[model samples]
Target: MKELYDTISLQFTLKDFHQQKPNLAFATAEKQQLIALLTYMRDVHRYTHLVFVTAVDWLEENRFQITYMLHNYDIKADFGIRVMLDRDKPVMESIHHLWEQGRVYQRELHEMFGIDFPGSPGVNEPMILEGWQGPPVMRRDFDTAKYSLETYDHRPRDTREPESHMKEKLYPED
Candidate 1:
């Protein structure tokens, strides 16, 4: 695993090396460089399966983090490549060229987070949250409470029904 990391580090300019208990992570990279790295992993390293792809919103930094998780059964380890983009203009290259599953993830991320995957098919269509406005819900900056208050009409709880007296009065209701 170290060898793989070293090789990747030497080949491309990686921003950071992060290892979290069970997973290894790499920071953001330029689009072309990221494509090259994914290509190398798919063709040379034989990481044939793309497990998943998702994004995280860093409200403080006003950025979105997109992570692609790849796995090779033979290697028995997974590699996660993460890229950060500006919140206002979150765009990244579609890895669908290398892995077909990328298309599904790309669509999901597009609808769920509003991140744009240029060149990916059907990115403009909605998968969920029909007629949603304001900010993407997954983004950290989007306050759920505020959204609920704004989007939904508040209703006071109904207290019209009196408590059942059968149980308290025992046999009286018979």
Candidate 2:
């Protein structure tokens, strides 16, 4: 595992490495570096499984964090790489070439968080929502209450009905 870390570090900047557990994390500033790292893990280090991809909204910093989780079943270890992107123009390289499941996850992330993954297909297609407007749903900037009020026609329910047990009580008239 140290050898793997050394090799990857020599080629790119590894933000963090953990030896006590079976997890490693890498951070890169460039999309090309992320692609290269994933390719190396797949081809050289035998990390053939792409688990999932997700994002975190850092509203204070005005950036979104994208994370790709990869696993090597044979070696029984997992790795996660993260990249930060501007919220206004969030874009990153797609890892679909390395794993097919990445395509679906990337597409969902694109629609939910507005993070763009270059070279990914069907990113603009709707998955669960139709005619979505305003900021992306998953981003912190999107307000669920406000969206519901605007998009849906809600009405207050009446609570004037008498209680069912009141009719059977001794002081029912009161």
- State the lDDT of candidate 1 residue by residue for 1-174, as single tens digits: 556778888888776666653445455565558889889888888877888998888878988888877787885778888877888888889988888778888888888788989898877777777776666777776689987988789997865433455454666655
Candidate 1, which ten residues in sequence have the lowest lDDT sum? 159-168
Mind giving the per-residue lDDT tens digits that candidate 2 earns over 74-168? 87787777777888788888878778888899889988998887789887887777887677899887789998998899998865436655564
The residue pairs found clashing in candidate 1 are none
Model 2 ranges off by over 4 Å: 1-3, 18-20, 23-30, 158-174
C-alpha TM-scores of all predictions: 0.81, 0.81
Model 2 error, position 2 (Å): 5.5
